[model samples]
Target: MTATYAEHSARKRRPLFRRRSAIPGFAVTMGVTITILSLIVLIPLTAVALKAAQQSSSEFLNAAFNERALMAYRLSFGAAFIAATINGVFGLLTAWALVRYEFPLKSLVNGLIDLPFALPTAVAGIALATLYAPNGWIGALVAPAKVAYTPLGVVVALTFIGLPFVVRTLEPVMRDLAADVEEAAASLGASRFDVIARVILPALGPAWLTGFALAFARAVGEYGSVIFIAGNMPYKSEIAPLLIIIELEQYDYAGAATIAVVMLVVSFAMLFVINAVQAWARRLSA
Candidate 1:
């Protein structure tokens, strides 16, 4: 009786959520994670900044802001933005269909969407270049459209690379969403479009923005596939990352770093804005 009473007393003393392990183990995990991140990310980033610091601020600006570099920047950001926008619109529809509809080969279709993730960037670029080039098999048909070796080709390459980010981001969110909300809307005489526009889209706002941000960032850094199709035409098809590589090859490390810093800053700002939009969306949902 006394032992059972003691056991009961112990149970009563335990908190609702007791610690499974009292060992202070996050210290090692934190140290290792931080060290790995610093080595891979912070160290390299710091090196770029340090190399650029070797030059005068005006020199760095002049090198990175020259007409060629500026044109590359324009092409890179412009193509990425257009690609991300396209991904956002179509990815949402794809996610909706996967979650809310059933059809033959649905699983196969889902698998195909992720093929880009497994394919080598070099291989993807080569294939796209061949597919879209003026006189190649598929290109022979489309060359009339003048799609390859032009700015349009860069957008296509970026769009191909960024599609998975959007679809994957929205898929889980759509799956976990309760059918009751839509049901409730329908029950209250709300049309399908109204339910989706007012009830669903608002809930999905943050995740959609997050997906767009990811796609945007990924597209901005893309080089392999774009290089093959872009023709690297100065001021026309060259992208910012390729321009930075050119600067580095020419022994202009400071110029490359300056451009790198600009890309980093702009990407960071974009991600920050996305995060803010997410916060606002959460508040709205609440």
Candidate 2:
């Protein structure tokens, strides 16, 4: 009877999580995390909301949806989407190469992958502009096509900044993939294309989507890297973040906040959709 009672007490004492975690003080850690996030993220967003509330509905609509603002939105989101898509494809290839078969100076190439992350946006923009400008080296090669000081320049800048996100995100997943599964598939007469398309792609789909989403999000708010190459023509290559800066410079605080709020809402919706897709992919894989 005593043993039965002891067993019941021990069972009740067991942690809800079956495995013991290396980290301790879950409640304290959770509280700290919430506090930090509130101070850093939630508080600023709340401030933006409060500032935007100062504007009347008509004023907000006029500021956010004016012809110039609309054009800026189109350019910004369009360039970001295009850049992220480019990154998704090339980044996957880069990650695969880094993981599978390394060549000469492979370590140098790996280090270079993170160059954009360490380089200042302004510096990167200037370098890209210099390299792609009509009179510049690479620019001379594609001179008639016209890259710098155009929407194409904006796309190039965005692609430069966004590439690392996709490459880094996919690298670990590629490294962890089981080689035996690939070998087994090949031994069963699966073509290389079939192995990549039917076996490898499905496994990496969620991570690829996550990387694409992150790249898109990062590109959407990019300012410094874009301005130098974009030329910032109001109705043409002007981006939304540049528009916000213009509003701020003109002391149109409410207008800036409204634009920011709109961007926040749209970005949130996009990220939410991406997250839903990722969740669906995870379920399918499982």
Question: Global lDDT for candidate 1?
Answer: 0.91
* Candidate with maximal TM-score: 2
Expressed as tens digits, the lDDT of each residue in 122-213 for candidate 1 is 89999998888888787798657877889999999999999999999998889888999899999999999999889999988888998999
Report the Cα lDDT for residue 278, model 1. Answer: 87
lDDT of each: 0.91, 0.95
Candidate 1 lDDT score at position 176:
82
lDDT of 2 at 215: 98
Worst 10 residues of 2 by lDDT: 16-25
What RMSD does each model have against the real structure?
3.8, 2.8
- What clash pairs does model 1 have? none
Best by lDDT: 2
